[model samples]
Target: SYGMVIGYCRGDHFPNVLYGYVMLAVIGGLYGCIGGGFLGLGLETTESKQPKWAQLLTEMVAGGMLAWGLLIYQLEWFMTPPRSELWAACLGAAIAMIWYMVRNKFDRALRVAIYSMLGAGFGFSFGNFIQGLGQASGLSYNWWNVMEFILGLSGGIAMAYAVATTKWEKTMQPSRTVQNLSIIFIFLILPLVNYFSGFTEEKIRDLAENLSVSDIDSFVLFQHIEAWLSITLFAAIGIAAWWQRASDRLQKWFSFVMLSSLSLCYTLLALIHKGFFHIELSIKNSITLYLPILFLAVWLGTSITQPWLNSSNSAGNKKIWQLVAGMTICIILIALISIYINNPTDRTPQRF
Candidate 1:
């Protein structure tokens, strides 16, 4: 999604930085909404009390509003120019999630958020530097996609490691209906929203033209079919949830199916964006398409094999200090590297 935004925001492309940033925030909010709301749904208080659906809604609203209204809009912190500023939104969402955890005393899960933020932040910065190196080498690869995959993989690993090392209470597990619904949101609904939202009508037309699709009308009809299929899938999931029979089976294979679906969706999306459908493969296109899949595979594999929340999880003062220091060094190094490797491109905006 950030890659698409970058393409659209380039001066030679759409030249709509404002639109880019707004969409970035919206993307962040959407992420926060799903992530935070699901986390809220998954955890329970010590007394076996669970958060109400309204409270989960509050997580979505708070995360979205804070991500949009705070640093992105009001404070105007353009910390990483030419890159998506959704980090601000992630932080905002983390704050909301942490607050809820503290309120509910789901303290064990707090490390998941903390470590995830740390890991993602480091991954993004490091990935940016790596991307710069790739570009400098003039390699025909999608470094941006590599960066995004690194970010996701690092965040997932950090969260999982945190969970694995921590001894968690056997809190109440949500019902099958709730679990199924949550899976649908994460694996299907939100991704579909992203697909439809990112591939706007204008974008589709541009992509179609570039791809030499003579029948633009038919191409658009194809997109409409995709959208309709999404709606049908969503409705089907809802019906399955209502019935409660199929949802269980659905959950068992949901990850694998979603992994394949998303990988194919993005690959097709990339082919259109790249304006070609051919047998010959570019290393860039391959990485851009498959790196996320690889990362997801790693995550899925580790999840199935790894023991979670079985060991002691402690964040002592020394560890906290070490984290802060390590993060500080990484930030400084990334800043220096970015400056040395390349000047900001058209996407970099002057905030002050």
Candidate 2:
């Protein structure tokens, strides 16, 4: 809903349909909230207690039909709606019902999906805000997509840790100081960064659309540097905390710091890159680009290692790390092969 609001408010993509999109989101949210509340109340008041699956099935059907009707009405309001709109609405309703049924059976899947969606939404919005800041700062690189992807990944990890573990609160209880700091870092610090650094929609769109593959490669290098830098910084912190006999809360905070740093650094580098604003790359520009990577590498490490390094069971840790490494190598090899097959000469240094 908020994504729709932001997209509509931009006025570039949906000039004539801004009001319509906003109204659709508003109605959808309201309908979901009110109808859900009423239905929940009805379920609570029922005298004949139905089996949980039966109750869930009933809720899914009701919710799906309600969503379908609401979506169709909204789509019809369009001046010349596509027939696909009806099909899309039907698909959405079916997905919702199926999701509910599946979630009723597997609670963990529902938890993960809900958290993932929340993470994705927050990450996307935050990335947009950061892109705006980058534009305002005269940094012309387009890293908004990367920012969203990394932030979403971080959000998912953090949320999964928070939800999946029953011992999170207990584990962190001894380190109240660290937990409070983590909260501040995640909520207050990050949002402030976005507010201060984000770019406008028009600027972000222009840069993103114009960027080249080489520019992206340079950006990827920056990502690699940032990821390793974050991992190293947090690893050091974790080590120090262990030495000081700090609580597990510090470990959790370390995780957040690692994720947050990677996300933030990407956004900053994307903004600072000149490819978006300049036609030709210069030695000075190259030097400027290499400096951050160098500094971060020196401060952190040259490569990313697992976050659980300080924890025991080093052999088990190696196994998990090996699996991740294998997957990454496979992906890179496949991508390279695909590119080679597509255009052998395209491998030559090409600039936009």
Each model's TM-score? 0.63, 0.31
Tens-digit lDDT string for candidate 1 (63-180): 8578757887798766555566776665565567667766766555555556555665566555555766787777887777776766666656666666566666666756788877
**1-352 per-residue lDDT for model 2 (tens digits):** 2333323322322232234332332333333322332332233232342226466556656665665566667544332133233333433443564356354333333333333333433344344444444444565565454444445444544344324331211121325678567755654465446433543334444454576444554454543454345444544544454444456666555544544444444444453433323345553343234445435643453244446433221113354356436534543343333332222132222111
lDDT of 2: 0.40
| Highest TM-score scorer | 1
**Looking at candidate 1, what is the lDDT of residue 294?**
57
